[model samples]
Target: MTTSAALTVRVVTSLEEFKGLACEWERLLRTVPGHSFFVTWEWLYYWAKHYLRGNQLKILFVFDDRKRLIGIAPFYLRMTSVYGLISVRELRLLGSETVCSSYLDFIVNEQHKPAVLRGLYEYLFGEARKTWDVLTLSELAAESSTLDLWNELFDEAGKVGEVVGTSCCPVIRLPGDVDTYHAGLGRNRRYTLQRKTKCLQRAGRMEYARITSPREIDAAFESLVSLHQRRWGTRANGGVFADDVSRRFHREVVQVLSERGRVSLDLLTLDGRPIAAIYGFVYGETYYFYLPGFDPTAVPKASPGLLLLHHRIEQAIREGMTTVDLLQGAQPYKLEWSTGRQSLVTVRYYNRHARAVALKLGEGVKQAIKILVR
Candidate 1:
């Protein structure tokens, strides 16, 4: 534990303690500016429930003199080996790795950002310095205030850190009306959407439905999984839902968020049979387009995937969403629809320990080799 002025910092390590924090956790999150769905309690908690088998929780909490929660660093520790030899302990953000969670950060009330960040820095690097060898914070939005503040702190402390560009998240800034949004699209895209919708309608009776009832979640989720697997079957890597654990994690997320009316699971059907599905979340004023699956064999010429996406965007516009986020990819389809892109980066900090020094040197050598090969 550590204290600075009117702030106190501490850690929560057990699952029960984490569970008890749901109310306070959400209260604090609401105060954060431009926070994403990935940082919500339901998302991170379910992720931890399914993915915490080999890792240890190190969630940090900050409070004011009045005992009000002010900040959260949802972190976990993992043991990683270098070259199958030396062991290194890494502190990582909880909703990372295989989940593809974007816009991750330390959830802090904007008013207490500096003080809370100072307390966190002191606690992590001062009192708890010996516990971790490296800190790896990934999937941070390039413009996130948390990213800027941490960069300042690391620079002041003279810590050995590197900020590396990781991925691009394409986004569409929506206008007030659906017709205006349609007008802004490129000519070719507008043509494709119109042609595809007409062709699909000509084929059969078409319907679009958003799954909201708890009873409908399981069946719709299974359909999503089947379509996702079928779409990726010919590719080298299998779909994300191929594993049972991942499926369970997402299922729990959708089930919990659905109660709050935040989950958006839409299916497009033809003649009473499902042809395409889009799974996403509605958080704040943005609609996150997280995943999509469509039958490649069913009316391939009609492009069911594209048509479903068009419908979702139209729905978002009508529902007062200001943005449509195609999270964590620069795929051609995403860029074609995007009006802008948010850059994501990974920040790595290595303490001056023997293991950390060796790892840093190894990383430098790898970079050198890559440059030479290029």
Candidate 2:
């Protein structure tokens, strides 16, 4: 714990204590600017519940003098082996790389970001420094305020930190109407979309369904998994929903968020047979295009996956959504439809301990070897 005249910081280590902070967490998240579905209580809590077995939670809470919650650093400690030899304790954000979570940061009130961050820094580096060898913060948005603030803090303290580009999230800003959006696309792209739609429609009766009911989520979600696997199973990197744990995690998240009208599980069916499916969410004014699957055997030339995405975009525009977030990928298909992109970065800080220094040296050697080989 750490305190100042206006701010106080406390760490929540137990699962029960973390569970009790749900309401407060949600409230604090809402006060954040551009808060997305990834940071919601449902997403992170369920993620922790499913993936927290081998790790220790180190969630930090910052509060005002009146005991009101002002910020939350959803962190966890994990023991990682360097080259399967040296064991190093890593202090990482809760929703790290495993589940492809993006826009991760400390949930802080805009007004008190500086003070809250200072409080968190004081506790992590001042009081709890020895608990971890390296601090790994990943998937932060390009323009995230935490980036600059933390960099400043590190510079002021003469601590070396590395920031590297991790991935890109392409986004499509929607207009008020679908026609207006179509008009903005390039001629060749627009022609391709039209031709695909017409080709698919000529084959059979096409229908788009958005599944949100809790009772219907299980079936819809499973359909998404099946199509997803069929599409990606033969590739070098298989489907994300291939494992039982990933399936269960997403199913629960979709089901819970469905009750709150936050889930959008869409399927494009031809003659009542599902061909393409998209598992996404509707948060704020944005439609998050999280995952998609399409039957390669079903109208392959017509491109069911692309057609399904077009239908979702049309629906989003009609329903007044401002953006369609193709989360955490720079695939050709995603870039074709994207009007803009959000850059994501990973920040790493190493302590001066021998273990951390060894780890840093190991990383440098690996980079040097890669460069020489190239």
Candidate 3:
């Protein structure tokens, strides 16, 4: 049966083909409800160029009858291990996991999302005949509209899927100004901010600035990454800057996004020295609290990192932002300031292949061991 006669699918198999979708990619982002700079071509392409490292890339596109793009599934197949098994072709979303591209999904234009998803699945299982052992999609918001739509589609097909909870993303619904925002905060956060601000002011000359110029981006972002590494220092399974590849990838993305006004790399300076920084991004009316760093030597009273966070929240409100996404972490600070939460899940689908069967069995055995231990 024709999945959707009005829609046609295209598979991009190489880097050159992927680059050609730049114009169409930007146009499609404008048609979606959830605005995220991390998912944009600027971010994804840079990530692919640096981090992909010879993985086979498979990009699927869904177009309407007029050949206008309606959806994009930027995916790649890579080798992974399961239960001592090696060389498994796992399909996953582009710019996912290692890049920390929050809220990843198929970029489906809302107007034709249903048809696009259905068309995409048809292409995956039908015409293309993908022999992928398992498909893994991660960092999708718990409330993701795409998750809901595809879940329904998969359920109808009687396919078994697994959704593992990953992270808790807290969000704040802004109310115009700093004063109002402070009023809505929990007592602890309210007092913490007030006390910390006074201490920070007394400490030295504190200056908070958001840099967006391409000329200034490189230097400022480099400093931000440095602070982040120093503060983390081989903790939390190693910071994002632990690997040189991720650092370079971010440098490229920041430079591009800063020019387009999609990024706000905030640096908080004290006594003419950089003490803290926050990597922030904007898409539509939403502000993403992407990454952060602070001087380890700074006193707790100054709360340099906390202060920058507070300032950015206020700045976002003043900018007329409707929501502040704290990205994919559930730290106590995020809980204190956040009024709501979003969960990211990993959806794994298996094919009727030897590799897939081995993975499913490995998972079953692993689950049994975990249960026995508990």
Q: How many backbone clashes can be found in candidate 1?
A: 0
lDDT of 1 by residue, 94-115 (tens): 9887899999999986788988
For 178-285, candidate 2 gives per-residue lDDT tens digits of 789888987998899889888989999999998989999889998899999999988886789767888889888988999999999999999998999999989999
Order of candidate numbers by lDDT, starting with the best: 1, 2, 3
For candidate 3, what is the TM-score?
Answer: 0.92
Score candidate 1 by TM-score against the native. Answer: 0.95
lDDT of 1 at 298: 89
Write out the backbone clash pairs for model 2.
Answer: none
TM-scores for every predicted model: 0.95, 0.95, 0.92
Whole-model alpha-carbon lDDT for candidate 2: 0.86
TM-score for candidate 2, please give it.
Answer: 0.95
* True lDDT of residue 159, candidate 1: 67
TM-score head-to-head 2 vs 3, winner? 2
Query: Which one is best on lDDT?
Result: 1
